[model samples]
Target: MEQHVQKQPDSPVPFFLWRHLNTVRRLVLLLVFCLLILLPYISLYQNFVAGHAYDLLTPHERRIYDVMEWLTAPIARSDPANNLNMIKGNTWSGTLFGLKLSDPLAVVGQVAAQFKLYWPFLLTALLPVGLTLLLGRFYCGWICPATLLYEINDAVRHRLVRLGILAQGRRMDLRLKYGVLAVGVGLSTALGTVVFSAIYPPLIVGREIQYWVTANGVGAGTTFFLLTLLFDLLVARRGFCRYLCPGGALYALLGRYRLVRIQRLVNRCNDCTLCDKVCPFALRPMRDAFGQECNNCTACMAVCPPRALTFRLRIQDQPDQGPGHQGPAHRRAAVRVTAKGEVA
Candidate 1:
């Protein structure tokens, strides 16, 4: 949406920047998911090449082998097996040009379970941790593969609400996820295993996509992920990410003092409340109350007609900015003060 707040002198929002961030975030989400899907086929092709199994393959398998070979022709012209291995692994942990990168939650989980830090693994998470510290739980919004599915599922929830098949949204304490995170860590420590990979939606999505695509049969997390979809559809809106995700809890904590945060340009706000309505996490962007729970998803900014929302460099959210200047409520209050010399 085009912003009309370009004339506001004190507006913090730069009319030129981040206006389309929501769209860019959506594209990045899809790209990450597409890579997850594509990687499995690449793995299969690498295996096929290693085994020299083209003649032994059935018709369907041969077709997959052929398609993958064609896709990787430029990259793997000389050494299909070695070259195609360059971009391996999923979002949980991956390598590109020998630079390993991983989710900070994964590093935390592994260390907690083993009670020892693998320096190599720990190093892999630095980039993500540093980024989260600066961006505030942006991984949930920008990179998580499961977030892509969760949002699409959220769209379905909206349709169901419109059809009266489901109620609007069920509210709960946002602190619930912190408890889940503590419990998850406790269990991992006690069990001496990284248990979150089984329950966390992002890792589960990556695992299941690799499994199902490679014909390894559906992983057990498939049922659990499906149940989460059901829960989001029937019980609460975006329930898993909103309340139960341990990874989200970890990210939120790490990003609690994040430097970049979305805020309302109160002067430009008309209190349309569209920002509040569109937030997946049920945050009230118009009220200037985005806390640690915000992922900087930019969905609020996209729906705002007056373009009252924008990212700002701040460690904490602004306190309630009250009614928007352009809104009728503020106008009525101004009228009352003008007539009676006191706020009504």
Candidate 2:
């Protein structure tokens, strides 16, 4: 006799939206990376034309250059001195909707340089830090160009693992990144410069890409960025981001009181461990719901077969319901889980 099987219901709209959002998020990151590479070349070409290279340009090239310059004008700085040295006409800093987008670490270094805190630097730092308070390390997961490279390396590693050519790498202590941050801050304070920028992967990659695009050669930081890629590929998956990224450590600290978090339905979880396996940061969403280490990537939510996970906004003092409850009834669950995976 033939047996009949029951099919499970489809996931809720939020889950479906989350799956598509992940794809959109990746596309956005790729677009940002491409823009970073292209902006420098555009600036270089415009500068060359302004310096009499215009006579050598084809009509079509001239039109393209004019259009690009106009398009990038709002975000691009006009003063050469204000731009990044490598990308002379391309600005490293800009305002987005009147909000400053400068690096907080750079701001800290500036304050250390003067041996006094400046209100302007503090105000500039607040823009990114305030966003982090709402989004929770979203920059690491959604925008950082180095994260794009890390994700590529991670994908390659996963393929190798499936083909029996690589092993599942061990997860390092999350505190290592904090320790690295402390050391970097100490060095920057002592040296009175942005010491972290010299080796920071994102900044290195940006400078290198700008150099390559404009000068047709790699920059001083290229070697450091490439070494970071190698470390991610062979030494440990996401080694730089997880344990050595001072910038990430700063974000984690800034995002400590993030309003949004990943919520888990304990009753739905069957302990399949798929969510844990898919997390690039090695976050165990099933066992440690809403952990601060979570970058809010939602990869776990997308991979969860039972639709047990979803992003939610909750107060810091909310109770943690161990694994089974769902919704408003579970609002007062036990204490929330800390970054160390301990019940707080």
Candidate 3:
């Protein structure tokens, strides 16, 4: 007779979408972000009109909209009634610049004069505030290209760690991001302008691509694009996210106060240890589900056969008794019995 041994279930799609360090998924998102830069490269017409299609007035929304507009460019089309190469106003260039400065390195490009007018600033602030009130950082998880880049990096780095090439995971290095935030804000204040947005990733990729097209032509842009792609693919995960991105760092700080949380059950846990194995962020959910590192991906909950974990609005709401919270010694004993039963 064959004995049955249970294994952990795969992580959920959302977790896989952004948090899973799986190479295939990371490749898909990376391609998507690259395609975003390729939008204006293809057509001056689509670049002019649809270029700002997603560029809402809010800082975060404009950033996300620009990224989406760029990524979806291959399929974007204009009506034949609108000529492909008609003269467009300077407004288009302005929109392009507004989009580029959002990058951290400003490697892509910069354009501040076009969209930084007072009206646009009002619009930028409203969007993030409104969304934060309604959704609680969905922008960080679902939209922001910077976050997407980091996720891709996270996936790659995790693989490197698994292979023992990297000794430990990348941390935001707490002080580093804070220092960046301080300097960026301080400079913006001293300069009497919102200059920090210039280095943000969305703007960075946008500007770099645009500059490459104008100065060195497509070859330069293509070269850097390929280089970044290679780094993302072969390197440790999220080379950019862990070490470089300030916008993502801002979101992580805001995310620390997020009301929605993934929680663990202590008593009912069989100590099968599936959650720890499945977590891609190198977090020990067994020790603390609310660890600051958790991005709320829910991989642990998905794999728990006993349904030991969940996303709860409040940690206090948890039933006060669940399988995930048991002490380590208790868990070890439980697993030993499970092993013995299987052996017998």
Candidate 4:
């Protein structure tokens, strides 16, 4: 029996969508960031002015509140304060979504406070940890507010470079982040406090946003957060996220063997090296198929002229056999090139 193979359409719509998917996802995350910043104010308004929760709002505010409530319904807990602070303790926390978000370093600190005291608390961190194990530091690419700032910083730097005003800074050793992570874990264990979160840019920025939106003022974390921005803006390109962030370090280590990764199609590639230049993390998607440092940010793929790069699931032990050698060793394929040269 003969099987009919469907050919890809020559329309530019699919290509357009694939190229802009990352931008769309980034905008969605930015929207989430805005909502998170506004949530506290919404809660305060509901409690103080409205004098009730969710029921006594103007139609507009009511709609926004309903959306937030629905989004956070899974991890939402009954707090006496009736505030939207999702953190329950040093162990379990919540993000904009209902999923429980936990910093592994913070959990370790709680564990060190007294193993028996925080042993049960460790369970709360499993969700994020499991996600990292499966997805490879997706939080850095998809959710972290720092990535947004880094992208802005990178764009400005690119413009400056085009004008010959800025020189690309030297690349630092990636191991520095891991070293910082080790130091943070050591200090947390020794001091009996979650030291990493206090200085972590993502957490600090989130807290500062909450404070600004709710109280119309900056919080204590603002200074440190600004320093991180300065470090990215003037000192080096993506220096904080790439070299010093202990949280990123934890994610990178936890996600070393993650199944999802960017793969290169050698036949389609023209060796323009644009992907390498566009990557904020300095990943060479053209050369490395399964770079552990890659966060799946899709920046490289966005700039690829031939669309040679794509996300795929491959076995950890699979050999780096370059491209055009798609063997049975690879399990799942997430993208395919059709006869008409369109990616699907």
Model 2's alpha-carbon lDDT is: 0.70
Which stretches in model 2 have alpha-carbon errors above 4 Å? Answer: 1-15, 48-52, 56-92, 97-99, 317-344
lDDT of 4 by residue, 11-117 (tens): 22224465665787589668656655656655654454335555556687666666655655554444423444543211225553344557675676566544545
Task: Give one digit per residue, the lDDT tens place, for model 3 in 65-85.
Answer: 456455544444434223323
Question: How far is 137's C-alpha from truth in model 2 (Å)?
Answer: 0.7
Best by lDDT: 1
Score each candidate by Cα lDDT.
0.87, 0.70, 0.47, 0.67
Name model 3 segments beyond 4 Å from true.
1-35, 41-119, 133-137, 147-152, 169-175, 191-198, 210-244, 266-284, 289-294, 299-307, 315-344
Measured with C-alpha atoms, the lDDT of residue 59 in candidate 3 is 74
- TM-score for each prediction? 0.92, 0.77, 0.54, 0.74
Query: How many clashes does the backbone of model 2 have?
Result: 7
Error of 4 at 238 (Å): 0.6
The 10-residue segment with the lowest total lDDT in model 3: 100-109
Per-candidate Cα RMSD to the true structure, in Å, reads: 4.1, 8.6, 10.5, 9.3
lDDT of 1 by residue, 9-30 (tens): 2665556557788999999999
Predictions ranked by lDDT, top down? 1, 2, 4, 3
